[model samples]
Target: MSVKPEPVSALFAGSFALATLSAPDGPQFPALVTPDARVTDLRVALADEALTVRGLLEDWAATLPRLRALAAEDGPRRPLAEFRVHAPVEPRQVFQSGANYRQHVIDLHVAHRAPDDDRPEEERRAEAAEIMDRRAAEDLPYVFIGLPSAITGPYDDVVLPAWAEKPDWELELAAVVGRPAYRVSVEEALEYVAGYTIANDLTDRATVFRRDMPQIGTDWLRSKNAPGFTPLGPWIVPAESIADPGDLRVTLKLNGETMQDESTKDMIFNVARMVSYASRTARLLPGDLVLTGSPAGNGMHWGRLLRDGDVMEGSVTGLGTQRTRCVAEDAS
Candidate 1:
C-alpha cells in the first residue's frame, strides 16, 4: 500500500484543548453540548469517508474545519459507526520496550524483592542501573503486532476471547506517524509525528512467553496480540495542541472506580527517543501507531482480573476518553 504522508506542521503543532463532554450544570441554559455528541475513532472516520487529508494526523488537523461546519448546522449531528474503525493501522511490524520507565523498573524490582529485606539505597540504585543497562542492550523495542481481530471502535464492547482469562488494562497515550520516519535523530523525531490519541494496551498477562528467546521465537505476539486487545478513540487530537507528548495526564477507570492516575512525565524513554530508536530499522509509515508504556497501577499486578460484567474507561488530557464494556466470550 502506498501511504501518503500527512504534513508535519499540521500534525505536530503545539496546541491542545480539553473536549467538553458533560452537559452544563445549570438547568436554565440549553446544553452547550448535545446528547448526540459522539467522538469518532480516526481509522473509522477515514474509512467511512474520504478524508481530505490522507494521513491520520493530517486528517485529524483537517477535521477542525468540518467540526466548525457541523457546529454551525442548526439540526442534530450524526454519531460515528463501528464499521468505520480500522484495526489502528496494522503495520507490517511492531515493536515495544520493557522497563522504559523509572517507576516501572522500581515496581519490577519491588515485586521481585523479598518482603523482609529492604535493600540499602545505594544497593537499590546499583541494581536498577544494571537492570536498565540490560534492557537497553536488548535494543529491541517491546513491540507486538496488534492483530486485526483484537481492534474495536471507541465505544464498542471488548468481548473477552475464549482462551483469555487474564484480561489486563494498560492506559497509554498512542502516537500516529504522519510521515516516513527512518533513522531520524531524537531532535528530529517529533517532526515525524502526526497526532495523538487515548489507547488501552490491553494484555493477556498469562499469555506472555519467555523474552529470553530470540525476538521471533518468544516475544511480541504473546505479549500484544489478542482479539479486542487494543481499544482506541475518542479522537486523534492534533499533535500541535499537545505541548509535550511526554507530559500529558493519563488515567484509566474500571467500573466507575479510578485505577491508574499519573502523568506521562514518568516515562523513562521519552517519545522522541522511543521514536528515534524504533525507526532505525523500519520506516514508521503514515498512520503507524506507537503506544507509550503504561503506568504502575495495572490490574495484573493485583490479584484482580477483568470479569465479564466490567466496564473499561481510558483517557488522555486533551484527547477524549474511550468507554467500553467487557462481555464474556460466551455472551457474544
Candidate 2:
C-alpha cells in the first residue's frame, strides 16, 4: 500500500491552520506567515497531520513557508500556558562533554590542579609547568551524562534544590540526536544532529571537586545531574540555519551581570569530536542530548553560588536566549 502525503498545520486559536509551500522540493524553504510567530512543538503537528517529514528540525525547515503563513495571518499570538520543551524526541540518555573549550581546560587546570596535593609547593609549581608544556599535545574531549530529572523548560523558573550547596550555571550549546549512531567517525557526526539548542548545565561545584586529591576531579554525573539542574531551549534551530556552530558567540548573565562571554571558536574539541568519541563507548540513539560543555567563570570557582531570586540569562548567537528566576526550594 502506498502512503498518502500529509498536510502540515500551524496551531493557533486552539486549532491548526493548514500550510502550503512554494517550492516543496527545495532545501531550506521559508515558513508561511499569516498573523503572528509562536511555535510550541514542531513535531506533533507534523505527525498528526501526516506531514512528509523525518524529524522536527528537517520537517520545520522544509515546511517553513506554510508554517510561517499560518503564524502571520491565522490569528494573534496566544500565551503558552501549559506548553513545555522536551528534547525534540525522547532521548535514551543525556551526555555531557567536558573541557571541550581551550579556555575552559586552562581554567580548570589552574583552578583545580595547580595547588598540588601530593607534592611540596615548589615541586607542585614545577609539575604544573610540565603539565602546561603537554597541554597542546594532550588535549582530548571529555564526556559525561546528565540525569533526565535535571532537565527543565527554557522559561521555567529554576528552584534551587535544598540539597544543593553550591549550585552553578554552565551555558552551553546542545545538539539533539536525529538518528541512531554507533561507532561513527568525526566526519560523519553532523549527519546525526537534528538541531541545536541552548543548555545551562547547572553544577554543584562545592561538592564536585576535591582539592586535596587533585586527581579525583569530581563525580561527573552527580555534579551536573542534580534535580532541576538542566535548563534547555528557547527553541531548536535546524542545523541548516546555523552558518558555523564553531563560530557562534556564547554569553551568560547572572542577576543581570555578564559572567561568561566567549566564542565557540575557543573550543578545544568541537561537536563532531565529542559525538564521535561518545558513540565509540556506547550506542547513541535518536533524541540523546549532548552538551558541548561550558566556558570559564562559573559561580563555584569565584566562591559564589545561586541564591534565592537570582535570575540567570544565557544565550548563543543565532540560537535563542533563556531567562529563569531562582527561588527557594519550599517557595516553588
55-154 per-residue lDDT for model 2 (tens digits):
3334443454555444445344332322233322334588987766666655665556534465555665566556544653575567887777788766
Q: Which one is best on lDDT? A: 2
Q: How far is candidate 1 from the true structure (C-alpha RMSD, Å)?
A: 9.3
Could you estimate the TM-score for every candidate?
Answer: 0.71, 0.72
* Candidate 1 lDDT over residue span 1-332, tens digit each: 11111122222222322121212241111111222343332223235333322333344455555544444456543332212322334334344455556566676775677778788866876787677666655554455446545555566677777777577888888777777789999899988877677778777776676546545454446656766677765455557767788888788888878888888887767788788878987787766777778887788666677888788777677665677788878834
Global fold similarity of model 2 (TM-score): 0.72
Clashes of each: 13, 19
lDDT of each: 0.61, 0.64
